[model samples]
Target: MSYREERRADQVAERAQDREDMRLKLEAQLEAKKIAAEEKRKDSEAKAEQTRRDAEAKRRQEQADKRARQQEKERNKAARRAKYGKVTGWLNRNPVTAFVGFVMVCSIVPAVISQVGALADAGVFVLLAALLSAMLEGTAWALTFMGKKAEDEGRPAGKYRVATWVTAFLAAAVNYWHWSEALPNQTWVAVVFAASSLIAIYLWDMKTHGSHGKTTEERREEKARKQHLADRRKHHKDIAAEADRLLSALPFGSIDEEEAFATAWRIKMGAEPGLSAEVYANATNARVALGAAFELGEHVRPELVRAGMLATLYNPLPNRLSEGIPTLGPTLPIPALQRSSGAATALAGIGMYGSEAASGNARENASEKDGGSTGGNASGNSPRGRSDEELEALLPKALKVAAELVAEGNQISAAALAKRVGIRRDDARRLRDRVIAERKLKLVDGDDTELAG
Candidate 1:
């Protein structure tokens, strides 16, 4: 019993020792894992902080670059504005001579630089040549600048000119000496160079400060051109003013008057090929007279005269009277005779006040004639007797007469039309109404008294 019990107790103690060793090993591994995790988190945070600093630095660099670019742009803009102002101000304040001198200096400077190539190089010889060229050119430039300043200030530029000439001579002499070595016969070369230089200087001076000595014919032509431009400007202004006045005087709903004013303005401005200044002047005068008559509430003979003047202006040909002015529509049978007769009748009836009843009768007769009453057939046909061809042929003439009368602000009275055309009063009125209807002519101010195109 003693041996068995002791063995069992030993086994239990050994088991307990083994479990304690295992627990110690597991605790060591857990502590090592926790330390590694803490180190990993610290590394990640450091990396994020580094990336943020780099981004901040890069953004600062970009801002610096943007500021630099803006500064450069402002500097360039200021430089250009200053240079432009200087050049333009000088040009504006000086005469053409200043421009000529400037051009000469520009040309001569480039030529001198090219000829004296060593002056532009990078050596002792270059230094010497550059100094020499600079001295000469600088002196010339200074003189030129002074001359221009003096001219602007209304002071004598004689001293400036003398100094410029002296500098130019020195430059020319130096160039001549430099070129003489390359050329044969140095004496002749020098003489030729000196002569050429003198001639060039003389020519430059003449071109800058002397007259062109234009011929009488040239002077006259230039004068004429200026006068022509002035006249054209005046004509344009006058036409525009008149058009504005006409437009203002017209009623708001008077589209026809507006169109007429526009047409008249165009014609006056030489919209048509054959129109002349004289014709335009006459037409403008006529229009002004017509406007005055309208303003005065006297609208008959003045309107007719204006129409005639406008027609003449519209077709301003030397042979217009003889060949008959070309019209928009078909030709009339006896246009000259009709115009003369109508004009005479208009003049005679200027102050004659006809009764309203008579005017009403005339209008009614025209209406009845238009409805196809055959009363006054000169062609020996019924009222509707004329063929389509005859009617077409007569229509243009009748329209012309009616247009003239309407343009004159006159009513198409059957009696007046009959007297003018030598047709029956009823027939004349019927023809007038039919022409008006077919042409779609509108009555002026909703009144049967006046018609407008």
Candidate 2:
């Protein structure tokens, strides 16, 4: 109990309290750091999710672009093949008119020279005008080749050629009647000039379409077909025009995204943007209303579906339109209700047949069986239906194709769907599972908990 011993004990007690205080401060600092780490982890996860979403969208855009290119190449091939199947051989698409132009251009010179000796003659002037009009018409039609609606550079050209010949014949007759003195020489010159004009037209046609040509009957048929196609284009164009007009009047003020989307739908569906009954009562109104009907469907899909406005199975359009034809690559999106029809056919290749295709046998068998014996037996379930290898094969093919398509902004089944392609069905699903792993697969059903692993 000496004073020095008591002082030492007090110092030790003070050191213990100081050490306790330091321990408590360190605990508080550690707890704060733990909370900050959790917050940082959450932020990183959210950023990663956003990056994944962006990548998915980019991939889908690329796929859609690729599909569009493929479709265009196919269309060009079909057009080129069809071009050779016309009547006027190389000039079938516009033969008659070209002939008429050549004829008029040649005959007009002789007719006019003969008439110069009788300038005031009414019949001469009338003949001259007729010849000029015919020549102009033919030339105009030929120039139309530069336009997007000219017939497939085939049989239509032939028919137009002959029309020019008739004009030339009329001009030649007039020339003969007016100047008989030098008639023989003038006639030969006119004939030679007409031939040269026709030859020029031939050279031009050859240059544009190459040597491939069509037969006579084919040309006539192609001409008739072109006329029909022209009619169809006019019909669709008129509908689109009306829709565009209605959408422009909307008052979305530009910033409100919902209203902006609504306006766009109005333009697409041919509805009045104001949501008025006038549009509802019209044919365009029905298209607009389908949007609502689509929302109420078994799947939460838009009734009026659209891809990136390019040609697809859902949007086939024409490389060129005639006066009335519905241009190819511009078909409306398949209706949702026709799922078993258009969607199945487009997605599953329900009716396509080819050796390279996996669905061909299944499609043929389904038909042979007079239809599926049960509803469960569909495109892939015929008696001699798709083999396991075929199904697995399709998965990879579909995933490759669909992923590419999705990158291009195309809508497709997020679920693993095996269907037809041309004449074949896909035969594998492993690739689909792989895509799912990359988070590329978007499940259509929100309630379904299972996802491809």
Candidate 3:
């Protein structure tokens, strides 16, 4: 074998290898084409399924819309029938009102159009004249409806009702003027034209506002309610300005009228609503006196309780000595009941019988005076019995207090002086007289009517 033979063998082997490679490449291309065809078939199937689902949803929607339309049509039909039945029922129930309304429409409409047309003949714009006529009649009806609505809501409807009649009368006057000018000397026809304008509204008013047989009780209650409101208005005139101010200041509907009036009364009068300051003061004093009497009755002996009860039938004791004044008498069983009936009677006797009774009975035993002489046990030390030296010691202080009270604008009464100076009322009276004489302070009441010095 030579080198040429070896080369020929190599070339043959290479050709075999090239043919095998070409076969593999062709098979790969065919397999790729097959895979692409399978994918394309799957995509087409998916698109067809999507189209079917869309068609099915469209069909269902169309059916649902058809059913909804049918239901709506039925509801509309039922509503129309119900409306017709309501109209028939109302016409049957209010036949007279229905007839009146019919007459109002029949009489007023033609007259308004004719009268307004006459204005058009006088060179006014026909459309504008028609609009003016409509406005006149419309205004009357609008006011009438508004008035009825106001009445229903319990508001004052008088102005609206009056306005309605005014508009109606104006319309009537317009018609009268037009018919008189247009139909000259046909006064009867002109009168008819004017009456047409008024009669319609009159009948309408009768239909809308006629009382439907109100019961006697209802009428009474209505009258009473009106009277009560009138009385409240009359009585609260003094506080009206303050109440109106509050009504404007506060949010609407937050406080009612009566509550605002009450608050205003309290703010202005410094007392309860509907009560004058004098009346309130008197009532408060009475209550205080009653409480004092009850407290005294509880602590005193049964006989003294009976006596206090009897004493209450006539004039009662004062309620308070002074504002913020301390009770300085010795503490009996009850510290509050410092003023006794004996002291009050003795003081009264002094005032009535003059200086002899005052000088003689000034220093009474405390327990015997308060408890009404219960023998030795009641003969204790005098609580309010001050000596001349003690009275002298209290005089300068009492005068200073009286000056201070006068400076503060308080009247110097004996009880007030006594409470301020911590002395008995009689001693307080003597000191008060001396202070008045020394200071030349004018007495507010012209005389010491409580207990003379």
lDDT of each: 0.56, 0.45, 0.65
lDDT of 1 at 15: 88
| Candidates ranked, most accurate by TM-score first | 3, 1, 2
Candidate 3: worst-modelled 10 consecutive residues by lDDT:
323-332
lDDT by residue (tens digit), candidate 1, 1-453: 698788988888988888988888789888889889989988988998899999999999999999999999999999999999998888888756576666666556654563355344423476677666666667776786788689769899899889888877876776566556546466676555444434545556676577647889999999998887567547666664666666678786675544644655665665553365776566544433432232211233554644643464456566433233232211211232335423423321111122233245444543355434434553344555445565456667776676576556455555445555556544665665566454332221122233223
Clash totals in order: 1, 87, 0
TM-score, prediction 1: 0.29
- Among all candidates shown, the one with the greatest lDDT: 3
| lDDT measured at residue 442 in model 1 versus the true structure, 0 to 100 | 29
Cα RMSD, each candidate: 18.0, 40.4, 15.0
Model 3 has an lDDT value of 0.65
Off by over 4 Å in 1: 1-14, 17-145, 152-154, 158-190, 196-200, 203-207, 210-222, 225-453
Residue lDDT tens for model 3, 283-325: 5444334333333211234456446534533544463322212
> How close to the true structure is residue 282 of candidate 3, measured as C-alpha lDDT?
64
Model 2 agreement with the true structure over 186-278: per-residue lDDT tens digits: 766545533443444444454555645898899999999888646644655654454345556655454343344455556666554334345
Residue 317 CA error for candidate 2 (Å)? 71
What's the residue-level lDDT of 117 in candidate 3? 76
